[model samples]
Structure formats: C-alpha cells, structure tokens
Target chain A: MDQTILDTLHDVIVVGSGCTGAMAAQTLLESGMKVLMLDGGMMDSKYKSLIPDTSYTDFRQKADDQYKILIGENLEGLNWGEVSTGAQLTPPRKFITDQVEIFLPLESNNFHPMESLALGGLGGAWGLGSCIYSPPELEKAGLNANKMHEAYRVVSDRIGISASNDDASPYTSGGFNYFLPELEIDSNAKSLYDKYKKKRNDLNRDGFFMGKPALALLTEDKGERKKCSYNDMDFYSDKDKSAYRPWITIEEMKTKYKNSFIYLGEKLVKEFSEENNFTTVTCIDMMDNSVKTYSCIKLVLASGVLGTARIVMRSVKSENVKFPILTNPYCYIPCIQPGMLGKSADQRRSDFAQLSLFHDPDKTNADVAMASIYSYHSLMLFRIIREAPLNFKDGRKMMRWLLPAMTIMGIHLPQQASEGKYLKMMKDENSPTGDKLFAEYSLNEEEKLSRKIREKKFLHAMRKLNCFAIKKIDPGFGSSIHYAGTLPFNDNEAEFTLNPSGRLNKFKNIFVADGSGFKYLPAKGLTFSLMANAHNVAKTVIEDARK
Target chain B: MNFAEENKYNSEAQILSNYLVGTQVDKKSLELYSGISKTTNHSMNESDLKIWNFLMKHPGFISSIDGALAFTNPKSSVRKKIFFMFAILECRPELSAKFMSSNFTGFYWVKFIWYGVHAVFTTIFGLFLLQWIKRF
Candidate 1:
C-alpha cells in the first residue's frame, strides 16, 4: 500500500465497476495492463442466500419480516411508491448512495434520474434490455459503424444476448452475432406475436415493426452462472444468475487475472489531475472520512453519466458549465386483453419485455420510437393498480381480479439536444459529497409534437392486436434512466468535448468510458453500446500505451 | 310493527347483506360511516343493523374475509375494525364456492391447469438439461 509500490504496481486506474468500467478493466487486464478499480459501493455476499424462495402467498405473509431483515428499519420510510413503474426498483444496496443531493429547478421536478453506487452501478438494477445501435444510429452518435460492430461482437460474445434476427432487424440494424437462444414468450406475448405475424404485411405498410427484443440473459448455463429458472423473481431477487449483471464480469476478472486486477471498495473518487506522465486521483474513503490519492499511468472515468461529469467539473474548478444532457422520453401504456383476464396466476416466469415493436414514422428524419411488451405479472400489480381510475379499496379488488388480463407496452422516444436542456454544476465547497449537480431540460416544440404522434400510432397498433381499454402513463423526463451526453465526443474536439477515443481534450492521461461520452442518446437502451464503446476505448488506451 | 312494515325492513336487510358481501368499503365510505355513527350515538341505523347482522351470522368468515380486505385497505377505519371481529360460526364450503365463482373465470381454471403441467415438465427437464451440459 505504500506510494512507491502503488505507483509501480498499477498502470491504469478505473473508477466505478459498472458495465462500462468493468468491461474496460477486463479488456485492459487481458492486454497485460494492471488495473486498480475504485468504487464507492460494496458487494453484499449474502444477498442470494438471504432472499427467501417461498411461494408468493407465503412471501406476502412474511413481507414485513422480510423487509425488516433485508432493507433494515432505517429505510422503512423511503418513498418506493413514487417510482411506480420503471425498469427495476432501487435495490437495498443503493440505500446509502440514493441520496438526493442535486437541486432541481421547478421545471425539472418530474425529471428524476436514479444513480446507484452499488458495486455494479445501475447495471445491478438494469432490466437487461440490450439493443445494439444500428449503423445509422451509430453514425448519428458520431461513431464509426465498422469499429462499433467489432466491439459489439466482442461484447455479445461475453455477455450472451438472447435474440434472433427477425422483422425488427431493419430497426436494430442486424449484423452482429447472438450467443443464446431467444427466450420463450409467454402466452400473452404469444397472442400478440401471432396477431402481428398474421397481419405482417398490413402492419409493415403502416410503419409498424415487431420482433423479439435482444436481452442480456442466458438461455444455457455459462461459467459459474446458472440458466434462468423462470421463477418470476427477476426484479426483486438475484437468486438465478440467468440474467447477466456487470458483477459477473468483475468476478471473472478477479478470478482469472487476480494478480492484474485489484478492487478497492468504499472509495469515492472526487477529482483527478494530470502531472507529467501520471494522473493523480483523489478519493474519499467512505468507511472512515479519510482522503487518499492514487497515482496511475492512465485514468479511466466510467463512474456513469452524472458521476463522471461531477468529477470532471470539480477537476476543472468550474462553477457552472452549459453541458448538453440527453435522455429518451419514456412512457408505459397498459393494454388489456379481456379474454385473458383472471386466467394466469402470478407464479410463472414473466421475463422483462419479450417483444419489441419498432416504428420509424418518417423516412426523412432519423427519429424512431420503440415499444416493448411486458406481461402484467412481471411488475408489482399494486403499483399499476394505483394508476387505475377506481378508489384505492376498489382498485385493489379490481386489480387483483384483472391482473392476469393486463399487458404493459413501454415506449421510448428518441430525444435530441436543444438550447434549453443543460446541466449546471453548483458550487458547494464545504460539503463532503462534492459539488451538487442540477439539470434543466425541456423538450423542443418538434420533439413534443413527435411524442404525440408516436402515442397515437402505438395505440392503433395495440387495437389491431385486439387489446382494449388502453391507458398510457408518461413517467416524464429522467424516468428513462438512460442518461448521457455530458462530455460528448466530437471529432473536431469542440469546446468542453472529449476526443473520438474518449480522452478529454485538455487532459492527456484521462479517458471516459461511460455514457458521458455519448454524442447522441438513441431510443434504444444505452448499456449495450456503452459496453462496446468502453471496449473500444480500452483498446485505444492499450495501443496508445504501446506507442 | 305492522306486517307491511316488517316486510319493508326485511327487504332492506336483504339489500344490505348483498352489499356487505359484494362491495369492498373504501376509505372515503368508511370515513362517512364513522361520522354518521358518531352523530347517531352508535344507534343502529337500518344499513348498520343489516351489516352487523350479516357479520354475526357469518362470524367465522367475517374475520378472515375482512382481515384480507383491511390489509389491502390499511387506511380505512371501518375495515380495520371489522378485521378483528370475533368468530362464532364455522366457515361454510358453499360460501367459499360463491366467493371463488364470483371472482374467477373458466379461463383461470384452464390456464392454471396448463401452468401446472408446464411447471412440472420444466422442473424435470431443466435439471436434466443442466446435467447434460455439465457433462459436455
């Protein structure tokens, strides 16, 4: 732990162990580079065994007891009801890091962006909705399509995606390889697919496209992870390693290249500085209140969009900078198939979003909207019932009876940067949590119009599938949980932009490997592309080191 | 009381009994009921008398049924009170059948059968598949 040994031991220092950071660290380790990864979160070893595997009825009986044991009494009052429907609820591990430190403007109150300081970052709570950027989408994001394909193949081979090239291929821009068989769709999803297949020609003419969504879930057992047991506990429990989490990669690095990789938990990196040929990183040890500095040949900041932006702004000693922040406008619409009402029990495995419906309404514009179909039982029915028009008591009774009949169609609309949408860094010198970050985002007139059009088109498609009683709930901004574009990459190295290789223009040794370096936030989920970009950046760092 | 008056009371009692069994009392209704009860000094109104009589007759079913409903309606005072009602009569199979028939459908029974068969096959075959993959 001495300074001399630390300086001699590690070549690259990576902040965060989420999807991007872990992939970067693994790639670097494989290329004979020693890495020191610092994370503010600690992994809970007893999580899997501690979670009970009982029937839902029995589980509900012990709900209070389980909550007390799992999340503790300290977080009993946390408003979980506020986040009704999203990818996943904040896990118990995020209790410490889920603090609301940002100051939101009046206009941005609905914009709630969740960040996780868990060992795997937000990837721990991710719905595993993995989609590769189409060639056009990649070009829009200012990335080389050929290089991205190479990176995508590398990522797909490691993560193992469950997908098949189908009708939605044109939208996904299919060419990349898939490693696992597509998951079997549930009866409800099968009904929708059958209808879509029957009316394929008509639907295609109406600009509607449907296919199985690419998911980062394993169909067969791989490594230490087991295949999905279809136990329907994906959102709350991690008992089955069938779903790919970033921790798996971190664990692989630790086991395979133990000598080359070292993970230091409970260390939150605040800022970094470049001196001569080495970068000095200052981090606070959360366990004890001590500040420590680590020096490395190169620094990679994959602490996520907001986390990385805070560190960069603090390093530059800036109070407020107009940085463009992008997010996909998200909404979930419920469609009821009355025939399927009160039919299926909630015990069966309801995978996240079995079918993805893609729509490109206009050929002139690159804008696209995607809707993923989810079974009713996949999410907590209590949350969905609250959105019902009935009173609380009546709603509960009705929801219980109608639970098996509902299907949620989640729509993600592509959002582009405008003059009003930007993040401002607050100057808080005395606080130990670093500077507070505030964002102000408003959709342009055109984007607002586009959203209305997309909703109408989606409802039409739902009606075509014999779904009735359609209700849409737009969760508003930041609910997408797909945030990017803080320190965007520019080929021209524009003011306050990262270079094409993810290295900052001013700092020679610093590299950003997360969504912060994205030039555009596409409608699809960002994790798959984030991992691919991280791999590309790691390769660039290795090649640069050789030079 | 006259025979006509007695017939009217019985008819009202029948309607209230159906309401107690079918409808879940929401928080707002419970609050209104509480206010009315306070103003009337807990004197049994026709509606209240019928509800109380129903609870007394189905004492064994009242607590469990009310308890489940009250848990889902935590904020309702009437539901909370009814949940702890004392039991005297044994729960009847006929009453249970009525509840099930009212709440469920033919589709539910068919789907449950399908799921049961599917679950059994997956459990057995999944284990075999894992073992075969491990051997490879």
Candidate 2:
C-alpha cells in the first residue's frame, strides 16, 4: 500500500469517462453533488496532432504528408489479412484501444473483445447513431421504461440528436423530444430511399422498414460546435465537433462545474469496499504503478462491462465464477447500386450511415434485427482491392469501376443470455490487476439459424430496393463492439447481480453505472440507451443517499 | 533494424513500385513510398525482399502471394506492404486524379468485360502457382 490521499471527502466518485460515466457525472453534478471521476483515459497525442483540418478530397489531392496520417507512424492499423476487432479502426482513432490489453488484461480464444479505456472510451469513434429504445426494449434490458423515457430526452438534450420522423420511426427513430434537423442522405442512399418510397406499402407488408437514420451528429450549429461540414472525415477525426464524442460533455462539465467536478486521468481503479461509512476505492496510479486509495460517499462503476466486472469480482474475492454475457451477432454485406457506377462520388459527403433498415418478418418487433446503410468512399480503395478476386493492379481498377455503386450494409441481431455464452475472470499474479477475464461464447444451432434467416430477409429487402447484396462477411463475435450482460439486474439480492436501482447488492455504496447490468443487448447501437441508464442510475443513487 | 537492412527493404519497395506502375522509377514517388515505410516503423521480414523479388514478375499472382507467403513464413505477407504502398502512391496529390480518371475510361464497358475474363484466368493461374510453391 502506498500513501492514501485524504483530501476533502467527495460525495460521488464515478469510474471510467466513457458514455455512461460521463452521463452519470453530469446528472450528479447538475444536482450540486460534487463528483470525482477516476479513469485510465488514453489519448493519441501523436495521431491527434497529425489530424489535419481538411476534407478527405483536399487531403488526398494536396497533402504531401498524407501517408503519415493515413498509414500511421508505425502502421498501427496494418491489415495482416486477419480481420480482428478494432481492425477497421483508422490510424487516428487507434487510441481507443491503445493500451487496453496492458492496462486491462483478458484472455479468450473464442471471444475477441474490444474494450476501450480511451478518454471517451469506445464512444470517441462512435457512429453517432442515436436511436430511442422502445419501452419493450428497455424492459428486456432490465431498465425501467418510464425512467428511461425522461432520461432519453435528457440525454438527447445533453448530447444533441438529429432524427426525422419517417417510416422506420415506430421501431427505430421516434419518441424523442429534443431534436435537430435531419441530416441529408447521400446520393447512393437517396436512390435507395426513392426506391423504398415507391414500394413502401408492399415493403411495409413484408416487415422491412426503411427510413432516415437518427444520428448524434449535429445538423445545425450548437453553441461552440459547428454543424457537420460533410467533409467525409467522420472516421479520421472530429475536429469540427460536428459529431458528438462523450469527451465533449465531460469537457463542458469540467468548466461549468470546475470546483464541484474533478477528472483524475491515469487512475486504473482495481476494487472498492464500503469501509468506515465511506466507499473507499483502491486504484493503481499507472504513472508510477503506486497503489493509491480515495474515499467517497458513493462509487459508480462505469468502466464498461469488462472493466466493471473485474473490479466487482475482485472486490468480492470471487474467482472463475461463470457470469452470463451478451453481444450482438454482426455481419457486413457489400452491395452494389448499378445506377451509381462509373461516376464521381459527391465532393461534399460524410461517411455516416444515411439510411436505417429494420427487418421483423413476424412484425412482433420482439426479435427485430437492424442494419445501417452507408455509402463507401473515405476508407480508401485498398480494402476492396485486396478482397477482390483480380490481381492487385486489375483489382485496383475494378474497385474504382465499382466504387460509386458500392454500399456497405452492416447488420446486427439482438443477443440473448444463454448457458453457452458466459465469462469468467480469475486471479492472476502476472496480470497488471492481478486478475484475468476469460470469455466463452458460442452461438447455438437455433441461434445461428435465426441469424441466417434474418440476414437473408434483409438481403432480399436490399435487393428489392435496387441494391444487390453481393457477399456477406460474418466478422464473428465482439465485432459489433457491443458488450453487456455480465453483471445483470435481478430483483433478488446476490453477490454479482445488481438491483434495479443499479446497486451491487453485496456492497452499500457501489453502483454499476455502465451496460454491465443490461440483461439483454438490443440489436441497435446501445450508446444512447447506456447514457440514459447511467443518468437514471445516478439519480437513483442520489435518491437512495437522501433516504 | 540495422542501417543495411532498412536500406535493403527501401530499395526493394522501390523496385516493386516501379514494376507495378510500369513506369520509370520516379524519384519523388519512390521517395514518398520509402518515407512512408520508414514512418510505418515496419521491419521487413528476412523473407520479404526475396518474396517481392520473386512476385514482381507475376503481376497476376499478387492476390495469392500473401496466402502463399503466409503458408511458408507466417509473418511474410506482401498484400499489406505492396497494396498499402500502391494505395498511398496512387493517392499522391499529383497522380490521384490521373489514376482516378483512368478508372472512368471511355471504353469502361470493354474494360469491364476484360476485367471479368482476366479475373477468371488470374484465379486459376494464382491457385496453381500457390499450390506448386506450397509443396516446398
């Protein structure tokens, strides 16, 4: 044990500065409760400085030093013909998982996990898809629907959302109060929308719903952040602040409540215990590898499922205990629009998904699968060229010939808790945290059949809309980057399970603020719902403390 | 890792670039490619130069060269190094427009037909060569 910092005892200490952690700190700070956030946040200073404030076309056409930013100083994103999680992440955004393995270690042969301890966690490179969860989805995820309804609006207002009320509204993008103007669809997506509109009735009868996406990207200028310039550099950088990163909120709260809120970075929290009427958090200062302790009235474990699970299990001295886990089964379908081929892509366009599609053949909306439609351009031509059957030189030419017509549709299906898929973390002396997590997830035959059947329906739906699905690549588990259900919410008290109010039933002042308690993982992007749940959890913590 | 090894890989990259572009080694484009390899901090495998020298003649074999190399030496894949070099060089401010314009060739319909036929032949040829090499 190193020195203990007995500074002014804080009221609330939130761990992790990602989407959920930021929201939890925001709600607590708003209510005048002083909050301190301990995080092992990382930022790619080398890559960050290299991000030039210019459009993709201009950079590709003018920047002589473009290779430094595109390929990375060390070929960090180098594709070795092996598709792993975080492989699609570009050079600039590589910091999201920069030192995650060294900081938070895990070993799994089947499950390839993508965990982020970056400043904004994994959400720094978020696609900005802001979908409001239905009441049924909230219930299934073990969240209070009534509470989430208000938190959804609160989260929507805090991090601005822009969505249009259209055909996919009832299932995907409706029921939110705070709104910005909808983003314009790209030409490739525009043609798909036109085709969808013509056959709306027949398509609706078949359970394929299409509409404009609800993205967190700003469509209109909001305060200091400018509206999206459509520079088509959504993946490379967010210098213009058009897209909302959770760090933006954390930064704002830092200034507004400077005295009340404190963000201590480089703190890898290990475990917590309720001692002497104070929740004491023991963490390792990664800077000097010194064990440090901080005491607060309440502690919020918002370091995501992987991080939070390790801490709770370690705190309780549990080892190799099987815990249920859930992740969205994901697939990427490359399709072609014959009409858009042999033409130049629009000079001003962003890589954000322009269209949203949901397929629920039974129309029950219970097991609905979702897909986001994006027009490919800025990721450059190397990826397609290597995958094509032709030689390198000819493949390059064939790709450019097929460039304008290409539309990549990433599909995701809802995940359920099964005996087959569970995670277990054990004590390890060699590990940095003295604990190692191992995940085992295998899709059952019925689950595989369900996914295949739903994907075929979605493929058919795309074909009807004039886009032909050429090939579908199943990127395997954890590719969707959606991890949840490790520490679930149950009404009864247990060692690892959490209560509805977000409390770890074994401890007094500890709350699992992130998606670890999500009993079910929705097919849609879970960032928005994670923020809402964190806000609701913070409020419940405040309420419980008052009582 | 050593100065000699770095220089050797850089020289090999220059040869691969010239062969792929089918043009005289433009010093500036070659320099750009060399600079990127240096920045990538990539240590070319001992087998890489040999593999590049071997594959330079078979342009149609570029697609299978990575699989073939991986079969022999798990670390020696020419796909990423060569394609990445080609990708950045093609994106050069001075040459991107020219290459892009070529893709929209006026006789694209003829080229599309040619691409299909060429693809079939390349697949057959590359697989045959890959199997032959894998035996060793």
**lDDT (10s digit) by residue, model 1, range A202-306:** 888888889988888888887777777676667656666778888888888888987888888778888888998888898877777588889898999999888
Task: Supply every candidate's count of residue pairs whose N, Cα or C atoms clash at under 3 angstroms.
Answer: 0, 0
Residue B93 in model 2: shift from native, Å? 2.5
Model 2: CAPRI class: acceptable
Restricted to chain B, the TM-score per model reads 0.24, 0.62
- Evaluate model 1 with DockQ and give the value: 0.04
* lDDT (tens digit, per residue) of candidate 2 on A163-263: 88888876656545477878888877888899999998888898989998888988888899999999888888889888989899889999999889888
Docking quality class, candidate 1: incorrect
Local accuracy by lDDT, each model: 0.67, 0.79
Second chain of candidate 2: TM-score?
A: 0.62
Over 4 Å off, model 1: A2-9, A44-47, A53-110, A172-175, A362-365, B1-103, B106-136
What is the alpha-carbon interface RMSD for each candidate?
14.1, 4.2
